[model samples]
Target: METFITYVSQNGFYIWEEFYRHFLMAAYGVLFASIISIPVGILIARYGKLSSWVLTFGSIIQTIPVLGFMAITMVAMGLGTTTVITTVFFYSLLPIIQNTYVGIKGVDSTVTSAAYASGMTRLQLLTKVELPLAVSVIMAGIRTALVVGIGIVAIGTFVGAGGLGAIIVRGTNATDGTAIILAGAIPTALMAIVADLVMGKIERKLNPVNKTATA
Candidate 1:
């Protein structure tokens, strides 16, 4: 514990910078994935026949080994944060896509029918009724992707992309690396926990039932 504290105090700036990089890489990946996934999810949900195929493809992509995927990407994108970001982006697709599909589909059917009968077009029904109710589930998927991304980003060190993993790697090379490892590992774990908590709050707040209760 003393060694961990001492190492952190002495190298706070370096560690802080790496921590920021780690988070940004993960955040950017999830952000980009969300942009594409949410729409695709909605599309599949509307066209239920497509749901199985799209989700199957996502599952296959998700199953690929992280390091292997990184290596495959590195050949084209080359090294550094870009490669790491690309890998994170691909890996983030499934959770966000799945959650969005489920969330949109889960919206009450009666409400949707009522909206359509009230002279709303497909776009209006989707935008006003479906999306509002589904946002929380979509957020949950984003949260999962971000948390997973944080862990995956640790492999960034091997790809020449710096993150907290770089610190942990440095510890691996040292004669006494336990404290150094903890310095990096602790922050990574804490970051995941914080991300999950914040996203959970956002999800709950977006939920209509919660809003009614609080009101």
Candidate 2:
């Protein structure tokens, strides 16, 4: 306990730096994943053939072990932050895509029909009605992707992308268990909590019906 406390006291700045570095990389990964997944997901929900192809391709990517993916990426990209970021981005796409498909599909058909009857065009109905109603479910997928990306970004330390994992790796090498716990465990838990809270806020804001019920 004393050693852990001392380490924290001495390395506070390093810890914060590591946390932010990983957090940024994870955020980038989520952004990239969403860029590809959101549109693909919408298409999949709207079209059966496209959905099958997307699911099959995304599944293949998911089935590959993280380490294997990293190794292949490093080989092609020659290792560094970019390799790690790319790996994380690919890993995050599956959940977002799947959730988006499910969320849009889950919208009530009657509501969609009414929107059409009210003279809303296809694009208007999708953008104004379906997308807003599906925000909660879509955000659920984003939350999953964000958390998963954060966790995977830690592994990027092996390829020289600095993060909390640096401390864990260094501590492991030097036989310092405290380093591993402080570096790996705490940041991950904190990231998960913060990400969940942020996403929850967004979900609430998007869910005006729930807001009205409460009011």
Candidate 3:
């Protein structure tokens, strides 16, 4: 307890800075992933034949070792935030794409038929009906990706990327730095928990049924 407080007091500004770096890394990765994956998912839902192949590609990417991916990307992107963000972007793709595809595809066929009969264009049907109904599922995917990205951003510190993981690595190198390890590990866990809870609320708010009930 004394050691923990001492560390926090001594490294207060540094800890806050690393926390911000960790968050920004995850944010950029998830932002890019969401922008690309949501559109690709929409396309896959429309063209059912592409779903299996695209999802398989994402799964294969996920199976790649994280350090290996970072190392390779670092070689190309030259070991900094870019490499970590790029690696994180790839890691985040599968969940968001899969969830978006499933959510959009799962809409009731009869409801779609009715939408078509009402003279809604393909775009209109998607924007006005399918997407609204699917937002909850899509948000769930984003939540999953966010949590994954948070964890991976810590690993990014191994490759010259700044994050709380630096504290963990430093602690391990010290003779007796258990408090140091907890300093990083505890904050990382807490960050993940806070993110999950916040996203859970967003997911609930996005649910059409919940909206209707609340209305």
Candidate 4:
């Protein structure tokens, strides 16, 4: 604990900069992924035939090793934050996509039928009803993706992308740098835990079931 405090005290500025960078990369990745994945998820839910193909592709992307995935992305974009962000975006897709699909699909059929019976168009049903009800589930997916993104971008240090991982890696190269490693790792873990809790709270708030009960 003493060594850890000493390193953090000495390198406070550097750690802060990297920690900030690390968070931004994760936030950006999750933001970009949510933008696209939510729509794709809705599309798949409407067209069940496409769900298998779309989800399968996402699964394939998720299965790729981060290093290998980054390597391939680097071929087109080269080493940098952009490459890391793109990699983060891709890595984040599966959970959000899968969750979106499941959320929309999981919506009560009777509720949807009532909406359609009231003369709602497909788009109206989706935007006004389905999406609203699925917001909680979709938020859960985004929460999961952001947490996952935090972990993925940690590998960003190797790709010349600065993040907390850089500090952790520095500790690894030292004769006894456990303190340094913990300095970086503790923040990363904390970020994930904090994100999950905050997002989970938001998720519960948005849940229709919760709203109904509260009412």
Q: Tell me the TM-score of each prediction against the true structure.
A: 0.98, 0.93, 0.98, 0.96
lDDT of 3 by residue, 1-215 (tens): 99999998899898888888998999899999999999999999999999999999999999999999999999888978998899889999999999999999989999999999999999999999999999999999999999999999999988899799999898999999998888888888999999999999999999999999999
Candidate 2 lDDT trough over 10 residues, lowest sum: 175-184
RMSD of each: 0.8, 1.6, 0.8, 1.1
In terms of TM-score, how similar is model 1 to the real structure?
Answer: 0.98
* Minimal lDDT window, size 10, model 3: 75-84
**Model 1 RMSD, rounded to 1 decimal:** 0.8
Residue 109's C-alpha lDDT in candidate 3? 95
Q: Please tell me which model should have the higher TM-score, number 1 or number 4.
A: 1
**Which tens-of-lDDT digit does each residue in 85-179 have in candidate 4?**
99999989989999999999999999999999999999999999999999999999999999999999999998899899999999999999999
What's the C-alpha lDDT at position 140 in model 1?
92
Model 1 per-residue lDDT tens digits across residues 1-215: 89999999999999999999999999999999999999999999999999999999999999899999999999999989999999999999999999999999999889998998999999999899899999989999999999999999999899999999999999999999999999999999999999999999999999888978999
Best by lDDT: 1
lDDT at residue 41 of model 2 (Cα atoms):
95
lDDT of each: 0.94, 0.86, 0.93, 0.94
In candidate 1, stretches whose alpha carbon ends up further than 4 angstroms from where it belongs are none
Residue pairs whose backbone atoms clash in candidate 2: none
